[model samples]
Target: MMAQGKAIAVRRERVDESVSGQRIDNYLLRICKGVPKSHVYRILRSGEVRVNGGRVGPTYRLAEGDEVRIPPVRLAEPVASGPTPAGKPLPVIYEDDALIVVDKPSGKAVHGGSGVSYGVIEQLRSQRPEARMLELAHRIDRETSGLLIIAKRRPALTALHDMMREGRVQKRYLTLVAGRWPNPLQHIKEPLFKYLTPEGERRVRVSSDGKASHSIVRLVRRWARFSLLEVELMTGRTHQIRVHLAHVGFPLCGDDKYGDFALNKALEAEGLKRMFLHAAQLGFVHPLSGERIALQSELPDELRVFLDHLDRTEPQKHG
Candidate 1:
């Protein structure tokens, strides 16, 4: 139900030929984009939405000539209990000119979704009030951290987006495998397919025939129990690294998605928090300047602490 505070008058935006065949609720949600579907439904269920002054069910489809009326609601109002900007994001690296790459910590999502108030991009907005533009060049899973790119201006955004589409953006990651890897250097040439569950969760897995995926992983260090590997992806699938690595029997440390829950729980009890993967390196053409650039993020605190624990548990192996 829409909030009981007070109904505010809302005029629906018009849609023409392009969106001629969308459902009413879908159209309303698009017009009220960013407003939660629940909120939209709240207004709808409370008799706040009407077509030509007549209450309409959510499933009521729309046609060319329909007058939609939305009851009082200010869509732009910030959600209640919004967090202060600073507490929301942490930046590990910053640069002047066209971009800023942050070494994000685990647990903080790359972009805010679900119940989160803000993500990395939202926090970075506060750092540059003068600039009218800022956006993420690429994304890393919320539980994963490393070099995350942010385009500071429209030109940079356009250039970077083009490069990403052309596959010129090179991303390298470092991950701690759950067990000693089978090969010193491995390349998995597989195809990937993304499956979305009914609950809205997305999972990517390997298939015999799907989107062509390939990545070369080389052993960086070996311990009595685990191995650190440098992984380079030639094709970027949703959960490519996590899924591929796990498919080959060496899931990333603390990767609850494709990794072992028992191991994650054991590590959590030992204060080994979050997933253990990092966007160790990222290289791309400068969106505006056309200069070649590569950025790296030093391992974060949580990763450092966990590695230190491994060093202590099996010093000889680290030696």
Candidate 2:
């Protein structure tokens, strides 16, 4: 039976030969790392799980060539405090009759509600009471700071949304991640998925069966044990860069969800606070002019200080 809004579904996957010696529950827990072990066992008991197209016991051994099917059920989670208004003012990057561009600060949401009293858009309205209508042209993570385009009118919002669906807009980010990259520039064509945990937190990872996510990464500079990276997203998914980078073994600095906590602490000690991801550039067509516009935001002060430390500790590569 499916939930009211859901289309009843069963996800089937084959057990890899390497996992031949594991317990069924262990195998399930390993593949779905963010889920609870008890939940995996519960599914086993519920008769919602099958192996080799047959029902299996909790302690059943997972053999090399078994097909596993899992029934679908929506996991419940409390909504995150949606975007809320901020007392701090915003820096406008670009503004026209159709839309207003902003270099949004971190710790703010693009949209309002869920649990938040006010988001960036709402706060913008509070400050600029003259504005008539507002809508988000695109969205970035709440923890991420930089280039956000807001439509000031409904028609403009429609036009921007249409362009985004057609993949006409481009975004670029600046970030710092663990370890040094062998290549100065490279592209990662990895697939990604967001695995929801029982605690209502989120984990991102690379998966064989996942949404296609592509990023072009460039090693801008390196410190004693870290690297500054420039990332241009070819396809967008939740936490795409953070997930792909972590899967490649170099999580972003200060990204608690998809980062190394120990390293984050060390960076924090150095006063390299906040997640290293920053939306640096945005390019899109004008809604009315039919002309293209590219906008950029300078690296924030914190990132600059971190860069300073890198320059002092590591050999600089001059272009």
Candidate 3:
């Protein structure tokens, strides 16, 4: 651990392979111990921190062999806490030297921040203290459940990120949406813009001046008032699937952010207390092994039971 107390003299660090490809902001957060995130950003904005003898933005990705100048900063002593309680191990879908895939449950954030005290990554780290490196390869919405990847090594993380950007990773989600879907197969290409609301809530919407996004929707099943769809994401954007479906007038069943609010309330009474989105499948080539990898996760019992209820109460439609 770095020293925690009065401000220390500036120091330089040589980026190693272990941390290569990580964002500079994230790197500072890790090594600065108890330094405030705001302080870190302040220094970056003021050019107090430099990389390779030049100032870089917070989003800059560090490469191996890069030299970093860390400015002097005071850090508060970490608060003493009681012995950490053992955390429940996440369900492992697959694991190797390079990466691990786990079945993430709905309602749990992938990592801690904002109002979340701790999240999946924190719990996993607590469970595997001996691991040298563990970082999220990708993220899913907190209300979305399914296969989530965590890279065990820095090289694998970089490779996985590249694969996602190049559209080599195939991600599929199962969702129950309001109203019947008309087409058996449809491609939705919408430009999405992300913005913050007046109250400071982050949101995304379909807009003309936004980045191009694509989703392939396949009707899996249908009921009188609800449709089950398998959506394959071609471009990963914030709230891409939810925003796209909702923009097409088929909001996800329990999506509070973009769905029908009144319908969601009734859904809670009907026992579908959470969003009906599940990351059902992921297919990609192994980042380091040169082998193909495919993983799947089953829908949670609540979603399944809700479907059964619909079958018993609502009229069936051809799927």
Q: Assess each prediction's global lDDT (C-alpha) against the native.
A: 0.77, 0.80, 0.93
Better of 1 and 2 by lDDT: 2
lDDT (tens digit, per residue) of candidate 2 on 27-117 = 6775554455787788899888998778888789877578989777444343456654447788999988878899998778886665665
- Write one digit per residue (lDDT tens) for candidate 1, span 284-310: 767667677778888888788878888
**Of the candidates numbered 1 and 3, which has the greater TM-score value?**
3
**CA deviation > 4 Å runs, candidate 3:** 1-16, 23-25, 37-73, 81-86
User: Which residue pairs show collisions in model 1?
Assistant: 8-72, 146-279
Ranking by TM-score: 3, 1, 2
Q: What's the lDDT for residue 27 in model 2? A: 63
Query: Residue 186 in model 3: shift from native, Å?
Result: 0.1
Q: List where candidate 1 sits over 4 angstroms from the true fold.
A: 1-84, 92-94, 315-319
Cα misplacement distance, residue 132 of candidate 1 (Å)? 0.4
The predictions' CA RMSDs to the true structure, in order, are 7.6, 15.4, 3.7
Comparison by TM-score, 2 against 3, better one: 3
